[model samples]
Target: MFARVAQEDFSQQALYDELCAHDQRSRAGAIVTFTGRVRDYNHAGAIDGIELEYYPGMTEQALAQLIDKAVKRFSLTNAGIVHRVGRLANHEQIVWVGTCAAHRQDAFLAASFLMDMLKQSVPIWKKEWVGEQAHWVAAKGSDDDAAMRWLTEDKDS
Candidate 1:
């Protein structure tokens, strides 16, 4: 498992290749990946860019824990998360999550679980820019609800 929070951008293809490499013995039969990009608009207005900030060591630790949990919970052979922190223009990549498992279901579920957990638990902040104004992005109720759904499902499983 690997987790990184950086100001520099990451290559999704490179990360995908690395996760694929985890199954050198041809054991993992499925690989799942998710990419999150900064959109051109939000609820308020047209977004020029977004500035992401995090607590450095604290944030990386939190992300690592999430990755570790997903790997164990989903019986994944490998998992990775790369989150970009800094000012990013619209359409720029913000985050990537990848999972490798023996089954497609496990890989897909782990990827989804990591995303919801990251949004709900990670110590990262985003400020969206529109023209001459900027505002801190608010946590959406939908995001909270999605995370809660995962929690409920995990309990039943």
Candidate 2:
């Protein structure tokens, strides 16, 4: 199976429903989901909103490849990823990932792998509105470390 990537408005219920529907169609025994939300604060303090930027086709392609790797590595039955673009308010959802597999371990690992890879490899960038100023948020080194662990595991295996 291949990966799926979508740019959408911040909507938790919609994503939850989509995930539930995907899970229902599966013969797998387990499903795992991860949702990322816009927080009220950042390193700069209170945040009013955030604007996400991406390279359109390139971003989607990169995300799809990341998901494909996760699916293959973990033997996932199904996977869905949705990332919100444009301006988003505090407490709104920013991203979601769902994975279905025959066992809990595969489902869990796939879901984690998708998120970690997205954070590290995906080209989507964010500009945050904090009070009167806006700034671009840099990708965290910790995220890269997390993603690299999987690569190391793959090399070892």
Candidate 3:
């Protein structure tokens, strides 16, 4: 498992390659990855950029717990998550979540689980710049709704 809060940019290809290598060594048959980028627009208006902040040790610990939860819940062979903090320009990558499993379903669900949990539970805060003003984003109803699914009884039941 890998989890880290980074201040520098990350390469999706490089990270994917590393995950693939690790999965191959571990005999994982499926892998899934998600990368989130700083969008150019949001509810306010055209976003110039965003400034992210977090409590260093606390943020890392939260992420590690998230990855561990994902791996155990989905029976994943391995997982990795990298989230960028500090000032980020529009269209720059902000987060990456990857999972490896013996089956595709496990890998997909684990990746989805990690992202939903990140949105719901991560310690990072964002200050988005919209033109001349900055606004701190509030938790969204949609995100909460999405995350609630995982907390409920199994869907097929």
Candidate 4:
């Protein structure tokens, strides 16, 4: 399952509980969860806050395809991703991913894959509000390199 919200807040405990509840009936032995939070600092300057914008239908479709790829590549039993949009304050939750698999390795790999792919392929754009100015954040080459690691190499290698 996948969900995206344009709200101002989310509950970490609630999300964790929901992920576990949804995967309880599965025969998987391992589950991995990842949560990303907004920090106060960026390379350019100190960010007071951030506003995320996404192309509604296209963004969701791309993310779903990414998740499907991760599931197929890592042999995951279940996977869930939630990304929050709109204005976000420092220390606020930005994204979450949960993966379940019969083995720990697959679960871990799937979780990593989801994050990396989301960073690279998702159509979400962030505008950082620093002091009294706002600037559009550009995608870093480092992120492309990180995502390429998974796309170009096999895990065992």
Candidate 5:
């Protein structure tokens, strides 16, 4: 029920607890979470950190829409997404997705779907600081493919 695109880091556990405190918690049997972290290396070999940027209002709206879609599609009790912007060191958390559902299958599937959609559609840009040089990261076709899988599965379900 919460979506935030901010410059500060988030606590995965806090996100979990927020879902657990949902009014419909008694009806939820499964809570699934996905945390994306910055690694030391990408295609460029090694990196020091990444600088993320996004238009404040638009980014938050887009994320809320993604979470809303997941909630309705999966019959989720609650859901939340938090993505970090600004400079972040390697190994720091970059994104988090959490879903609460009546069953394990729904929770897992929703989490996966949200993550894929976020990567595919979100306007958040990333500039990786690789050694002394920086490069704007490009979108991967793999992310598009993964998000497409959910669209196809949505109709089937």
Candidate 6:
């Protein structure tokens, strides 16, 4: 398990390699990874960049908890999450979630679950730059809906 809230940019290949390193011999048949990027457009206007902030120790602990939940729930072999803080340009990588499991379903679902939980529960905050003005980004209803779906499904199971 690896969870990091970094101030600098991360390489996708480096993360992927680290994820696979712990699971050799094809023990974990599936590895799923997700990368989120800072988009050029948002509800406010054309986004030039974003300033991301987080509560130091609390942020890392929250992320570790999310990874632990996914690992136990999905029976994953390994998991990793890396999120970038500070100023990020449009189209720059903002977040990465990776999961490994013996089967594809577990790996895929765990990766998705990690991302949804990260969005909803992580303490990181974002301020978007729209030309000369900057606005704090708020949690979206769609994100809430997406995160809630997992809870409902878990209950049904």
Stretches off by above 4 angstroms in model 2 are 1-26, 154-157
Model 2, 1-157: lDDT tens digits are 3333445554657665676676576688887888888888876578898988888888888878877887777877777788878888897878878888889988888888888778888888899997777899988889889888877785223
Candidates in order, TM-scores: namely 0.94, 0.85, 0.93, 0.92, 0.93, 0.94
- Checking candidate 2 for backbone clashes, the offending pairs are none
Q: Candidate 1 lDDT, tens digit per residue, 30-96? A: 9999999999998866889999999979999999999998988899899999999999999999999
The window of 10 residues in a row where model 1 has the poorest summed lDDT is: 148-157
Please give the TM-score that candidate 6 achieves against the real structure. 0.94
Q: Write the per-residue lDDT of candidate 3 for residues 88-140, one digit (tens) a residue.
A: 99999999999999999889988888898798898999989977788898889
lDDT of 6: 0.91
Q: Per-residue lDDT tens digits of candidate 5, residues 1-157?
A: 9999877888888888887887363688898998999999987588999999998899999999999999898888899999999999999999998999889998998998899999887889999997777889999989889988987876235
Candidate 1 clashes between residue pairs 3 or more apart in a chain or in different chains: none
In model 6, which residue pairs have backbone atoms overlapping below 3 Å?
none
TM-score: model 4 vs. ground truth: 0.92
Worst 10 residues of 3 by lDDT: 148-157
Which residue pairs come into collision in candidate 4? none
Model 6 ranges off by over 4 Å: 155-157
- For model 4, residues 97-150, the per-residue Cα lDDT tens digits are 888889999999889888987989899999999877889988899899889999
Which pairs in model 5 have colliding backbones? none
The Cα local distance difference test for each model comes to 0.90, 0.77, 0.89, 0.84, 0.87, 0.91
Work out candidate 5's RMSD over C-alphas: 1.6
**Model 3, runs deviating above 4 Å:** 155-157
